[model samples]
Target chain A: MSGPATHVRGKKTLARSILGFVDKGLVNAVLVIVAIFWLVPTLGLFLSSLRTVGDSASSGWWTVFTTPAQLTIENYASLLSNPTITGSFWNTILIAVPTTVFVVIFGALAGYAFAWLKFPGRDWLLIVVIVLLAVPLQVALIPLARMFGTLGIFGSIFGVILFHVAFGLPFAIFLLRNFFTQIPAELLEAARIDGASDWRIFVQVILPLGGPAIASLAIFQFLWTWNDMLVALIFTNSGSQPLTVAIQSQLRQFGSNIDVLSAGAFLSMIVPLIVFFAFQRFFVQALLAGSQK
Target chain B: MTQLVAPVANSPAGGDKRRPPHGSSRRRMFMIALGFLAPALVFLGALVLYPIVYTVVRSFFSAGGGEFVGWDNYVTMFTNDSTFTAIRNNVLWVLVAPAACTILGLIFAVLLEKIKWATAFKLIIFMPMAISMLAAGVIFRGMFQENPNLGVVNAALVTVNSAFGQDAAYPGAAGRDGLGLVQDRGVIASESTVESGSEQNFPLVGIRVDSVPAAAAQAEPAVNARAGQLVGTVWLDVVRGGGGTSGQIDDGKTGLPGILVDAVAADGTIAASATTDAAGRYVIDGLAEGAYRVALPAANFDEGYQGVSWLSSTFITGVIILSYIWIWAGFSMVMISSGLSAIDRSLQEAARMDGANEWNVFTRITAPLLSPVLIVVFVTLIINVLKIFDLVYVIPPGSAKPAANVIAVEMWTVSFGGGNNQGLGSALAILLLILVLPSMIINIRRFREERQQ
Candidate 1:
């Protein structure tokens, strides 16, 4: 009886292992297919950009695999040499950098206040920030556009950056506050006992410990400001338009210039892709902080 | 737990009202908090709060803000056809795009659990999220072009059709005026009947020179009609670069190759059919001796599956929504995958131990546990889609812009997109705010719940 039971157990284990293997195989297949589906369109765009305009227009992008000699970098050369594309690329940096810097600074300060500082209506103020997170930026565009006109900042890069900073603070503060509140009370108390003021403790203790959160906030704010379009569209005119608006303007109704668009698109995508991959972990951490208890 | 510790640390000086130091400490903390919050508050007030208030006020006034119209703009928003179309399209987007992204995201997240190279997969999928909507718009617009030579999608479609031995039709061909053919919609048909042994001449015009197939031969009128057979010539009547007689197949005219011609009996049945060759000549042999209408069927002028007119009014919204889904599905995947990782594995393992299948375990144990994250992601997408402007503004062609308009784009158009009517735009803005408020409330509540947990 014991021998038969052992044999049966071995058989069961073998079947289960086979099932597990099949499960893994199935999962990998789906993942691979989905990954390919997501990557192919961008790959097609990139490949088409690498080919001459006539070659790209005459054949499907997949044909490039068979005919490698058709590939050329002329599109990229022309796009980079063009003054408007390069100028807008710099304009994007100008807008993104200032917006990111100010958002992080202001967000950190406000986050520190909400987390550690004891003040009248602190909870109410924090709630306000949380609620503001839901306020679509569209609601503010008209009034703000008009106000920018009055302040002589409409259609300027400064106006665009200021709008991004204002809109970015809510989520930035929310994330930082969550990070800051998790700090042990004993750390802040010890700093106070050492005669450090609130400002000193924030700068010395909280700021240093909140590296992940700050990194997360900076990455998020940077990506948002860099990829932003609607605000820039309504606020910035031709002189101050970012790469997004510039790319948009190149889109013609009939017989669109695919060569320029493909190259410009690839160029615009490169910086954010770098930022994303470099700080991917921080982005995931930010996602967890925002969603997790 | 931290909340419980916070007040105790602040009250270390004791609760005695008589202590001057304690009162001073509380006041000092308040002042410090205010100082820390000052810059963010100023910007938030000036940009977010004040603008919100001013938009509400502006919505009540006339276009130029000179008169107090008092809900007149709101009335126009509901009354105007374009604005109404915008509202309807926004509702469609809200109903479709977010749900699709979330579901796709959830599936990708769940499937990622079984793979070794999950990180790479996630990165590729999430790569689109990094691209600007403007770039995405451009990519999708180019991809969905109607011409096979210009658009990747149509090119693939044409390849597949040809591979399956299906001949493509000439969508651009039409009958020349006074060619004795009746034109209905786009299909052209011979009005008079022809005898079986008689020759027919189908002289068509309006086929663009570049659109002509490269294999097409020079047009020649058919001659030497055989008995009990019908012969015809379908050629481009217009001659390039010079004057040509109308409704006549003159020299230098190109053949309308590959057009399907049919001989229809009086009972509306096709008696015989033939396809034109390179020289625009076709012959239907063995036809019964009867008068038949030489017809060009609708398929001949069908525009021949130009791959969906993605930028056309009928499909512009769908294309925009598709682009939105592409960018956001990766975002949803990453968010939900993180949530999936946080889920307690023991619950799933226990369900499996009970002899449950993978689907059962997932639906019963895993999905239930992941609901909070799913709801958070879904609501976030809802708010995001409500404010979607760039894709709508950038993706659709000028002709389809009105058809694909979302509230955000409508707001811009009414005020800035050459409408220059700020009052109505402000009303549209407020309507958008009201539309987004419910999801925003749900998201905040979800955040509060997550914090509590």
Candidate 2:
């Protein structure tokens, strides 16, 4: 056989061998493992949340099967009913919603600026921001708290909201900017030639087409703000602790009542998961889309 | 979101000033830009910027408030005190964890995602990812427990040990439980009035585990005490020369020294501790049946720091960088793979027909086409790493043995860990937000640019 034919045949054989291996069911087995990896903790968290305090600590949640009827809803009932938890849950919602909304709105705008706007110090500002991204969160906490004290906003919902907004803006901007930047210049140019105002153009042309990007950005910001413990712990007072702080504060010095924590942990994750799966289709593609650029 | 509308501002401002019937439109555009941006900028400036300025000022002043010390705290931190140690340990963490995690993450993302069990692999790695830093610390602390660390890491080690047919050398005979033992016995006799007597009365004591059958019978497991591994037990004993209290050693094998006061309080606490023997040996066993930490005193510590938190603002920064690389690499790979897939098949066929080699076509055509996505990925990752707190915080913060501390974790620790000084903690926090703000703006701007494109 000629060299090209030989090489082509070799390549085809390799491909065929790979396909044959997949056809033999290795791929399916792997998928099951993947499903288990993702599902187990979720299942563990779910099962653990429902289990008795003793069961959760002494053994894995899988052992719940020994007495199939042993599953209890008491944890959930208690979680919802617990006065502290109830307040915190509501507080989390309050903190999370506004923080997420603002961050996304701000992020989208900043992203657009980086992508399309010609302004003084754009490159320098970009460099500065890149450098800023590396600053540790620890360095900022104390000063921010002091600032809050001066503003009389410390230990309140406002303080926490402000903190989340500040922190969340960067990531949202980072991801959204990449997504917005990739929109073909021709599209915006077309709108410009048509005399579409920038705001009109953004709202009409960019925002609509940027749906997938926005969805992902919103989801991330939502999860981040909702799950954030440090800012909430510092910025809010007794009346308005978010779930993470509330749950963490409940930690008894030696060992806490693991059951409540189990319940609380799972509950906290609920929104993110729901939000994630709710937008799972958008996420699957966009997870790497903006990230690549 | 106003930033999202920035481009709209561009058209009516200097960029498109000559547009017909645009006198009111220009005013409307400026109003829109201000309207869109005003709220966020207000919130950010009030919450983030002002605080950072306070920290920069605070860092130079004394706690009691005096004159501008001009980087005195910075100087003191670098020149003296345990803060230096914290910096060192943090540096090591920055160097090690992030780079490793990111590289591992990238590899895992690429390989594991392709596996039939891709989700499972993702879940396993991401399992740690999802857990809060405090929770992960608790879990890891358990996993890396000090005596027989009963966590997963130690269990694996024990399994490995069993496979090799090894055991702790001897029972607790390595040291007296709480009693003191002399370390050296000089040449001169106790009653000697010789010129060298002052240096001669050094106490020398040794445990005869072999001679004491019972002592050897209850020997604990001796195991590795590698840095940050977290589980193992050790003990040490000291016998006094003249019925005098020298120093009571606890852990008998090889481990760092921490006080284990033998004098039990009236409450009758066991106060079981493991202090290393003269050879710096301590063996801690029965560690709740899992992984544990065993450490030896450092001969000399080399300084490394993980940088201050929010963004990894240090020369020794590591974890953040690694994670950024990992996520970005994976992201780029995904995009590139897609881009590769999207390449016009007809073009490749055309190239083949023209007798161009595959490598030549790929270099000339594929790479250039892939550039946009790659740039987006790298820049976004740099920004993402700046904003990230989750992965770094999960590690915990400490500088002695590379405290798994991240800036975010530090913020949580200070704000909640109940310190005597809230002012300092707040200062640190304000600094964190300030540091992140500029980047936040950069990211948003990048987003706007992207959107406009």
Candidate 3:
């Protein structure tokens, strides 16, 4: 009986090892392939941006590796030299930053109220906000544009910012409300017993505790406003147009200027990539929180 | 300590002894809550609620919002061919793009589980999510360009084709008008019959100078034709500049190489066919001594692999949809991956221990558990794709824009993109709102379910 048991154990170990090896091999193979598939298009764009216009037009981007001397920063330089492109870059910053700051502040305040503070009609109001989450931005564009026009803020960065802030509130309020609800009610009560006013408790306790949620909200709002084209397209005139609108206009129909396109596209992509990587963990956590209640 | 004291502090006797009475305190708290909620509510009312109401109202008016039209714009929208096309394309988008993204994301997420570098893989895949839709549109537009030298996708396709010994014939080639060949549909055929042993000359035009192959030699008239053979020359009639005669092969003209020329019998059947060489010369040998029409088959004049015509009316929506998938698939993957990670590994193991195979374990355990997340992702994507505007607006060229329009884009076009019909645009906006509401309800319900769980 001992001899048969020993033989069985040896056979089981061999099978387990083989299984582990195959699993690892299959996982790695799939990971690598998917990674390549995701990376190649961006890789093509990046490599094309690095090459001169003539070189890019004459040969494939893959050929840049074979002829190392063909790479150039001329496209980037030329794009930077253009006044409109540079102006639109600043315009994007002007719109995104203010929108992010305002949305976070208002969203957090509203979220705190809905979570802890009790008021008449609070539940109904919260429900209203929740339903507003589904309102397609398209439904608002024409009416809002007309309103902005009447208000004389149309074709301005402020108009765009206002539109963004308004549209951004529902999601921000929803996310932060859910996040704020998880805070222990006891903590706020204790603060209340310590003679802190409601505002004091909110400012002193809730704000600090809500860092992750706020960061997530800020990142999301910033990215949306910065990368936005439709809002900026309708609201901002020629002077206040964001980088997205600028890049889009540069796309000529008859013959595309590839040099401007590749460089401008890279320029537009870089800032969001920076923000995404910088706060990637927070973003992921927010996504989980947002999706999983 | 705090827990024991907390209840006592919150007890009515203790709290009443230290604080204001319930009525005034409630009023003050309500005011404070009002203060906090006012800004968001005001913004929501002024921006969202008011606009929505106004859109519904204005939709009934005329283009300038001056006259009440009473559903006329809605009638116009539903009846308009372009608007119908937009609706059809949008339906296609909602059906295909989201499903493709969700499935790809699911595959990626599930496969990511056993990998050591899962974080890195997820980041790379999610990278496109950071790119603005405009940039993505640009990238895809360039990537799908018809010109091989310009578009990366076609460049790769051309390389693969050439590697496999298949090559494209001249795209955009045509028969010169008033020449011996008559152009019909896409085919260029002989206007008159030629007897065997006669040399027929076919002059082609409209091939771009740069598109002409480097191996193309100067046009040469067909050499002496044998008694049993038919011969022809297919050469570019136009010169680089503007000085060439219309129907004659002029000096400095180049041969339209690789053109397929055929000899047709009286019954329209192709009796013989020959492909042109570098000198634009083809000789159909072993033809019977009879009258035959020297013709260029439609395949010769048919547009060669111009790499998909991505910006054309036929494929513009597809190109835009591709771009959307590229940007959002990463987002779906990350969302679903987090859900996937929260799944119970013990359940999977238990199924495995019960002698379930990998596929069964996945199908029975993993998929059912992940269905909620999948539904949420799908619903969110549907909501998103329904209103997709930027890629559709930015990717297609001017000629194809009408074909690739979505409801959101058509709304903009009518209101702003030169249509200037505010009533129609408002009606379109309301229609979009109605369409998106169902998906939004589903998504909200899913969110509530997830929260309950």
Candidate 4:
């Protein structure tokens, strides 16, 4: 008893020392540096947008302390009020939120079948879906854009959303299917025996249980659409442009108002951060069966 | 793709085992599969399979129905030497950026998990990742704008140069005397890419430089005067061709080194100049070219951060690594976290009761069982990395010339960027697909395997 206890005690102390070092300095320092690394550029952008063209050229935003004190929030104020960027923000919302919703709903339904259904070619269908996930987005873009243009949806927000949903479905389905398989089959069989229809079974039995998968999938789709610059650029024009495209227009191959950009970027990010935090409980990707089986 | 059969409770060979379902159970399963999977299949075939097949067929025949080249594009990609360099560069990018970004992301994730403010810290690090590379490129391009000390990087360099490195000599000295030196302010439309950001600053032009006393410059006046001079301030625009030849400075056609005054400042506040002497050259004697600058009083070099607003480009030397890491790691972390959470807690408690420390519990008791998740994460992330474009597309190359464009970028540029050369773009893209598909297939197989387990 003494020998084992002492061995455990020694190991615990070693673990403690390692944890102590990490907690005391190394980890905190890394996190702080990483956070700052990302933050400074963003802040620089904010400062740049606010400063006059001359001031931006003459000095960095960080150097504002030594310079003539002429800081202003005009960049943000101006950009937020602009018709193009402002409108695009709404367009982005329309595209992102709906795409997220569609992908989750469809992916969950499809995943449920793949997990529980015993149909002809069930295994083949899943394999085909996985292979579909391998398709590069670029290879599909031009052709899809052409198809969309032909269908009269290319220039519209709907086209972009549809494209995102279509692409997002495969991976989303894959994730949900994987998650669905881990759930015990007895629960589903019990619900079925108790006379639940397929839809009822999905909604009452599986939906609540599938929160984490849905949330993460939603997060993925939302971010993809929100930050989507490529499809939007190709399919949509000036009026339908998203924040990324709008911001790209502001850059004059020579110099740009950085402060406005930083402020604008921050503004663009606000919703995602909120969504991420709001969904933090679901953020724990494996709370199924108490997360630990 | 290898077909993964159903997750039978036990191997069919091992007794009747948990017995594969029969009768009504089998029929209900077929109904479920048909109902749930059809929507996903239709979309996949329509969007993904159609285009890939189209590209493969289209690449074989040329734009105007040229004879089937049958691997000609692939041949050119490898044999055309320049294209090979591009492939090499692409390989370099794949090697450096993905690994660095993943490592950094994992490191940051692990580190940040400890902080009370971990969420806040993660937001900050991952924040850059969230910002479209397009925005990032622009911001960096501006900072790298090369007016001697005008660019942020140059300004920092100037501060450091003044603080550490020497201020350059005055502009009076003969040009091309031995070494021709001049300092001129550079311009950047994008932010400065801090590749070599930890640079010393050069002193502001017209200040310390003017004090070099024109007499030292006068030491070679006859020699300098004989050298061709810019009677008025001149702008030398380097175009794509005019591939330079080595020669002594000649008037008009050659040699800004041909001039006594290499350049008059754009503002005219400083007549600071370089003198080029006999071997047909003039050296701007005193100049601080240490940082935040494009030394236009010279040639062949522009600021490293010239972002291409044309066709949408930003030249960030560092952001490539930064962006790749954050995104990939963020995804990997989700997998890691979820995988760990999936393990039964009793096992953890059992280790605890047995006196296993947290480390031992995690490593010995945990990681072994977590192999499924690790495999899933590794395979998925690798697949994601293989076809990465959106993030790369956002970051325009940060140089006058990009170090290398991602295959996706190459595809877009080749296809629609003016030349209307769909064949080449399609070919490059097809090649990219060939490279990525095997791993992707392997990943799917693994995913199916884990699901079965």
Candidate 5:
């Protein structure tokens, strides 16, 4: 009876392994198809951007695979030479960099205080942070636009960056606070016993320990600010419009300027891709941590 | 603030041996914490909290902020056709877009587990989450262009359509003016009736010579009809070099084949029907002896199978939702994938050992385990979708914008997109906030529960 049972178990294991192998292959096949479906839009845009105006208008982007010589950088060259695209590109950097830096600095300080400091209403304040995280920018636009107009900074790059940093704080503080709370309290307590001030402890201990979270927060904020069109559109005029708004202006009602649209869009899309890939490890780590919130 | 600080200032003589004056130190800690938190608090309070309160208050005021007009703005928003359309579209967006993203995310996450190139697949899928919604709008706008030659989507549709043998014969062909054939409601018919055993001719001119089907042969005149039969020819009337006579099936013309011809009797009933052949000629044999009008129905000249009018007002909302799903599904996928990785593998192994198939394990075990993560993603998506503006704003054409309007875009348009009605826009914004509030509460509750755990 024991020998027969063993034989049956061996056959079951072999069959299960075979099933698993088949399942893996099937799943891989579906994944490949899905990946292709997912990549085709961006891929088409990339290929379209590299083609000449006539080629883009005359045929679909995929035809270039058969006739590779149709590919050219003329569109991109013309796009770069256009003052509007280049200026907006510069304006995006101008907006994203300051927003990122300010959010990280203020968020780290506030997040540390929320995590470690003994203060009244701290939990309530953290709850407010969570609530603020859920507050959509639409809620703030009307008043802020008025306020900025009153302050004489409406439609300025400075005004846009201020709003970006302001809105970025909630998630920044929330994510960093959660990460900082997980750090061992004893390390900070030890630093305090040795006469380290709260600022020193935060800079020396919490920042180093919360590096991945802070890095991810910065990336998230930068991307959010960079990709932001609603806020930019509402706030900035044509002169101060970021690449998104600038490119969007060229979108005709009935006809397409495919050459200009594709190149400008690709240029806007490439920066965040680079930033995201470069810090993908931290990005993923932050995603997992932030998901729990 | 001074009440708390006064104790520290007055307690210089109250130092204890071990704690170094607890009240003063605690006060210092509070002050330090306050100092640390002040900057973020100021921004949050000024930009987010204050603006929310101000928006609510301003919603009750007049457009120029001069008068307290009570709920007039809210009533106007509810009554206004555009704003009402915006609200309805927002509901549709919240219903469709998030659910699509969540479902697609689940499938992608689950499938990624069994694939060897999971990381690469994930990267490809998640790549869109990095690009701006404006850029995505441009991509999808380009993708869904009406012209098949330019848009990849329409081009693909045209390819599959032709591969399935569903090409239109002649989309825009028309009869020439002063010709014997008269067109009405896209159907062309002879001006006068012909008795059976008589011949008819249809001279079409609108279709470009080159645009005619490749299989079309040179124009042919109808053969003389036999007894009790009607014969006819339908061919491109214009000659290639533009010297052909009106109503004549001239040289260099080709047949418009596969066109349906009807022989309608005087009683408004069809006595016989025939389809044109490759040489544009048709024979209706065994017809009754009464006079019949040879007619071509509307189907042959239709703007046939012009790929889907995706950006039309009717389909604009759906197209915007699709683009939203395209950009956001990867976000949910990455989130759910993280949750899946955290799930214990032993339960799935146990289910497999018990002879449960992959589907059963997935449905009965894996999905149940991932419910928490799924709820988070779903609620997050709900909140996100409620505020969707960019894709909604940018993808649709000017004509279709009203159909695709969401609350966010409506608010923008009302305030900034030339409406200049800040009061109405504020009310719309407040409406959006109210819509998003429930999900935010659910999310906050979940966070509180997680914190307690």
Candidate 6:
């Protein structure tokens, strides 16, 4: 066990036991239990939404197994029929799409500069963006709310979109800049030596290469804007509130009306889930890259 | 002439035609970069940077934003109970939620190494990371309902308790007024001690007729007790349609079944005890020939497990933290798992070969090696929890909001949750920034260092 032969054996055994900090059986059991624990709440929400108000109020959701036929789509039907919720769904799309578009456009443009271009104060400017990433949105809420009101756009979807774009730029720029830097500098310089102007080089060179980062950033911004309640709550009027704010109103009013609340919650959740699952590889990759740094 | 002409073409200002002078070209590059960056910079300056500076300045102003009041809002914020509660709860969130998530994540990351269905399990755990805090709040709020019938948590607790432990037979049951039995501290005891060979009757009232067990039979009067024995009957004295004697069992009166009856001697020890039958009759067959009090212990009428009032002021903070951990633990796990995969496994193997057990290897080698990843996750979580608002706002009932308050939610409340005091709100916002700045700086430094490396 003291020589090169043992060292090789150690590597093989270590590969097997790298995860074996405890008994394998105990580890498996705990993992399964935790997985179940993580799953139960979301499962409850889905099952509870399908249950009638009376059925839901009388027994826990797991009891639905005893009488599975009682599950119905009425909650969802009613949720869709409600004018406020339906309108808010449209408002969410309205807010999210434009915000995503704007963040991507601006994030890509600035990210290109920070990545390939030489300028005075560039490093310091990048540092400012990093610091801005740390500032919580709370600091801006009061002043911006007042500013939006003075601009006569308060309580409108446009104002909410504007606010999101503003707050989202730091992170967008940060992520895009980092990702753009990874594009080989020689490629951009070669394009430049061929007489392509900076703008043409950005459009023809940087944007194509930065596609995955831009998509990831777009998905992140869209989901964030779609799921946002705080910004919409302050900036949008009732008429223009997104699904989050709209559902929040339902939560406050209905309290434990799981029938209505669960339907609304699942509705708000499903889009992000779809987007997330569709691009989860990129999403997780971006998260790992962004956070690890 | 060609040489002179060529010299002039390439000399001084002529170079500006083919390629700009160095200083001017540098300035031109700067202009182009500025043009590209201006939109984002403008938005950041106005929305992010300017608000930060404005908030700091506005903290000194009045609620109406008119009169200058130096340190008044800050003073009030520090002294106010709700603000203090918010600050204290923030400290708790900062302390507990991040560490819990990070630890749980590390566990999950390590555990996933040997598991067969690791990808599926990882997906299930990480699913919540995609969810909004608002939806997560709704999920948790429903999961922690106080009623066992509704709340899954309480239902499981109640089921486990009933299977292995005693639950109160009649929670919230009480005795009739002016009856021979007295209700004291949830116990219904005979007002007078009954000697052996005598009967004691407990005719309880106040239980709704519908709540009476369906299996309970009509009340039957207790039979005469033999010498050295005690007998008793416990029945629901109230009858439907309001036609029953106040302290006596009447027609259609149902028995309170499964209630424990205790006979305590003068020394306060239980001489004998029996459970009431379907007819509410209990016979303690071999009691000592001494006087004993026929009483129902508090357990008989105990309110049993109503589950936890998770939204109550006492537990709301914990509930919110639990939800935060639920949503965030996966993030930590994913990060730590990446780190785990990137580490050298032979070091752990060597340690194990040197007689270090699994736990020792994990603690000494694995954990110490993973510290960089762990610190990143921990600091990121610390920063995340400091500004947590959605679950705290949406999960707690309005009654428990003060207990669940953190600086972010407090700032919102003071400004727009009907307080209409943006000045104090700005003060709170600044305070939050102050609390969060150190973590931010650490993260930025780490980011810079990572970039350099």
| Candidate 5 residue lDDT tens string, A178-219 | 888777655665665667776888889999998889889888
A best-first ranking of the candidates according to their DockQ comes to 6, 5, 3, 1, 4, 2
lDDT of 5 at A87: 96
lDDT of 4 by residue, B1-453 (tens): 012234444233211122256787667655665666667667767777787787787677664446677777767667754446446656765666555654454445444545678656644554444445555555555554555434555566556655653333233222121222333343111122111112111111222233332322211112321122222221121111444222212122222223233233334343344433322233333333322221333221222232223322233434454546644555555445555556787786777668776579767877788766555555555555656555555444334234445666666656754546566667777877787787667766765664566
DockQ of 1: 0.42
Model 1 lDDT at residue A227: 88
**What 10-residue stretch in candidate 1 chain A is worst by lDDT?**
A1-10
For B57-127, candidate 1 gives per-residue lDDT tens digits of 99999999999999899999999999999999989998998899999999998877767788889899888
Sort candidate 2 into its docking category.
incorrect
The number of clashing residue pairs in each candidate reads 0, 136, 0, 73, 0, 1
- For residues B253-286, write the lDDT of model 3, one tens digit per residue: 8887887888999898989989888888899998
What is the lDDT for B30 in model 2? 50
Which numbered prediction scores highest in DockQ against the true structure?
6
Instruction: Put down candidate 6 lDDT per residue, B35-101, tens digits, no spaces.
Output: 9999998898887888888999999999999999999999999899998889999998898999999
Kindly report which residue pairs in candidate 1 clash with one another.
Answer: none
Candidate 1 C-alpha error for residue B254, in Å: 17
Q: Report the candidate with higher TM-score, 3 versus 4.
A: 3
The candidate that achieves the highest TM-score relative to the unseen native structure: 5
Model 6 achieves a DockQ score of: 0.47
TM-score of chain A of each: 0.94, 0.84, 0.94, 0.82, 0.94, 0.91
Better of 3 and 6 by TM-score: 6
lDDT, candidate 6, equals: 0.83
Candidate 4 Cα lDDT to native: 0.56
Identify the candidate with maximal lDDT.
5
Taking the tens digit of each residue's C-alpha lDDT, what string does model 6 give over A58-127? 8878888988988899999999999999999999999999999999999888888887677768778888
Which residue pairs collide in model 3, if any?
Answer: none
- Cα error of candidate 5 at position B259, Å: 3.3
| Candidate numbers sorted by TM-score from highest down | 5, 6, 1, 3, 4, 2
Mind giving the per-residue lDDT tens digits that candidate 2 earns over B235-306?
323422233243332333222223111211223332223443333334333223222222221211111121
